[model samples]
Target: MNIHDRPFFAPTRRLALGLTGVLLALTVAGCASGSRKPQPTPLEPVAALVSARQVWTQAIGPVDPLLVPAVHGGAVALANAAGMVTVLEGETGRVRWRAEAGAPMGAGVGFDGRRVALVTRANDLVVLTERGVAWRQRLPSRTFTPPFVAGERVFVLGGDRSVAAFDAQSGARLWSQAPRGTEPLVLQQAGVIGAVGNTLVVGIGGRLVGLDPDDGRVRWEAAVGRSRGANEIERLVDLVGRVGRDGDVLCVRAFQSAVGCVDAASGRTLWAQPADGATGVQADAERVYAVEANGRVMALRRSDGARVWANERLLHRGVSAPLALGRSLAVGDAQGFVHLLSRADGSFLNRLPTDGSAIVEGPVLVGNTLVAVTRNGGVFAWRPE
Candidate 1:
């Protein structure tokens, strides 16, 4: 399933932070590209004096309606609406693997570096290795989001509102627990396993729950602001989970336009601010950057949730989450355009049309190359001139 961008409001106070000189120079030049369609920008071209390029391009599926492809370990893996996992090479858009799951694999695919895993709407955990099916285990219900891969364990959310852990290698049932609420919509990547805190954090409808790394248990829980109305999309909008020391901090953006940051350690509300149409949120040691639903991007202090800089002209609405490339930010929108912005001041940098009709899935930084994925299943790699 694709993430939906929702709107939210922020306090009026402007955030103050030191801006880097090198980043400012890049930001100004990156935004210099005019708002006109043209040939694909050459790889290793000049923008703000720095070189860039679009190195490679490849199409994945049938490219019918266009779907947001997920990036997994040097590959763009797509579980098309037809219910199959298609893996494409990261550097070159070459097909690495394809497997039929029979039903439409609704839950987006996830990878543990070695294997690509998909939990279908039918509650089946289909794991794909290099050769083929490593293992397949049925769960309780349909998985709305990708599973969380931690060490040798993979965490899947069941339709019965429980989180189950399976051995990544052996596909053995490690542990399972029915938490009070559902897990978050975003999937998580594992780092150091069983270090501390919960490994999985999920927000079902309006409540957030944390699960144990060793065994799925109730580490903590918090109630988020819910949306109103009869057809009130009972599910939590889109949640972005980021790793933290104590636990992962989940940013849940609701359709009703509310944003909250919950600490997975104690299941407490760290801080929350009014926000609307927030697409993607990325955090650094200093601040968290977010792309609003209307294509407006803003940065806020990681500590107090204060607004830093707001750039509305970078890209338009229906763009993918703003991706961070060191001091630079890249985003692709509905217009099939990739934009590079300055992370220091949220200034526009370069705008290049990928010459495709699909929504941009990524401005993913693969090594020194910037890879943007189009909805038409095309992958374009850009590099510095």
Candidate 2:
């Protein structure tokens, strides 16, 4: 269902009668004014200050917005709903390797150069290597966030709010964290999971928790959101998947609640601001960027969480999470157009095009090329010229 503010549910399975779905529809309608969806803002004449060119195009079949292109050095790993995973050279768009999971995938392409991990709809965590499928392990619950591959281990954030670890080589169960309190409803979208320093940082509900990677012990926790809504559906506050990382500090969004930065090394909340958005954020050294409910792009000062600039020209465009590449901010819209904006003042820099379909997720940069996969499964790469 297309909500006027933003997407609360990117449904692959039918949630036709769920209370969350119904309440979300009502909640989004309350935010919008007119009876019909707003038309996307028309583009003005393009500025020729920055020049970019299409580098290469590859196909991997159609993908949903859940799939984010994983980059490792010069290689980028991507997967489609049909379980076809392809690794391509980022610069030349050459196929490095390809593998199939033999089932419909739920989430995937978590790569650490040598190890690739994906989860199937049937709840199997499939790990692949350059050679082929390395091992298949059954998970305790359904997963949305991609398996985070690091420290010779695969860490997964399950939809049930469980965290488990497996050996990268043998697929042996090392440690598991049981679901943390009873949550009324959890987001079907991916939650943030990654490694910062020696601590494995994970988003469990609205709290950013840091656990010891060695034995999976809780080291510290920082709250980014709280359950203050009137109902269970409104009370749902889960961290969106992507992150803005500058050294040990990480910035993440608590679904439609707040955006905050956390110190991974010390487990401290640097700052937080009330923000109504469902997608995660991107950041550079100076600023943290987010796309709000109505497609407003905001740049927040990294140190103090102050508003730097808010650009509303892309409103109602159904833009994806932004990619902070070099000096420009790039985001793909529903019509398969990538708009580049100035990072300083959020001015329109340039416009790029792809096959007429939504880009599946945010763009990933590799070696000087920005790679993006479309909802129609068109993988396009653009290099600055």
Candidate 3:
């Protein structure tokens, strides 16, 4: 018998089954009594990373807004849902400049040299050089990754799974690929990184696809996660990973179990090892690290994907992306605790607190200052001393 069809037992299981069954059954039949699931434990506060005097707080927009900031040149550029991109000085909460662009959506902002490029909801590549319109190209479908600018060439992927290359100077399309899927998820930039050589590692349809920087040719392909259930769509959603490349090792979040490492040149699986939770993946010279969604931090060897160490304390249910800052590894959780782990053994080094607030968006690291954007409309910065 199907799991959802099974009779509910305890209140916790009954609530969970009822919710799942309602989605499948489309209506609740007979519930002897309505029962609510036990609420998850309230997240306790982690220690602060900086002293109270060192804290800086600011408001950008509404609560739960998708105003993710992109760090560049000691400044954080935030894009609002209304298609406005605002540049803010990193050290202070002062706004440098703001410009209105396209309709607000969840596209990303990219940087090449001093220019800021935004992918609009209209599927257009808008390039802003020195805060001015450098050029704009109207594509056929929406784009999610801020144009991958490599030198003068900007590589972009559309909702159709077709990768296109355009001249950065002009909006001239150099080449384009055919659409891959009817409802392709390639438009979402899962993970992108320019490798050591002329190789570019991109997550296409939740799978890691390597391409040559010279021309957008598929050099290699590696599946990062295993398929789940029978439906193709359900399996694709579980194949989530933010890929990274250091030298020749391709680092990606395989599953909740481990980070999968493959040879960048040959597309061969080197190894896969255990991690704390399903988190973001990052890499440096020494190790490949993941900050599991449950806020645990883990480090693995880059050569064979072997576990180096892992720390789960001071972490929350949801966590931020891992930052491999050579000697230190940083991650922030929803509970507002940003932990710094030693790259050598994954030992806890410092904790950056969020002043009792929760981090909803980021634990972005630029230099020594780690910025945590909170859910209570506060952006807190911490520099562990």
How far does residue 256 in candidate 1 sit from its true spot (Å)? Answer: 4.0
Worst 10 residues of 2 by lDDT: 1-10
Pairs with backbone N, CA or C atoms under 3 Å apart (clashes), candidate 2: none
lDDT, residue 380, candidate 2: 91
**Higher-TM-score candidate among 1 and 3?**
3
lDDT of 3 by residue, 276-375 (tens): 3344577776677777644566777777777778876644445666665546677665566666667887765666666555554446654456676665
Clashes of each: 28, 0, 5
Which of the predicted structures, 2 or 3, would earn the higher lDDT when compared with the native? 2
What is the TM-score of each predicted model, taking all chains together?
0.71, 0.91, 0.73
* lDDT (Cα, tens digit) per residue for candidate 1, span 1-385: 0111011001100001112211122211123343443333233342563346667776554432223345545666666656667776766657788877666564556664567677665668888766777788987654545665546667676433456789888889998776443333322111111122324566544456665657666677676555543321222233332222212554444332455666555678777676764344566656667776556778777676789898766434455666666667777776577777788997666776775654543466554667766655566777755
Best-fitting candidate, scored by lDDT = 2
Q: lDDT of candidate 1 vs native?
A: 0.55
User: What does candidate 2's lDDT look like per residue over 193-284, in tens digits?
Assistant: 88776677889989999888777899999999877667666677888767888877889999878999988778899998998887778977
Off by over 4 Å in 2: 1-35
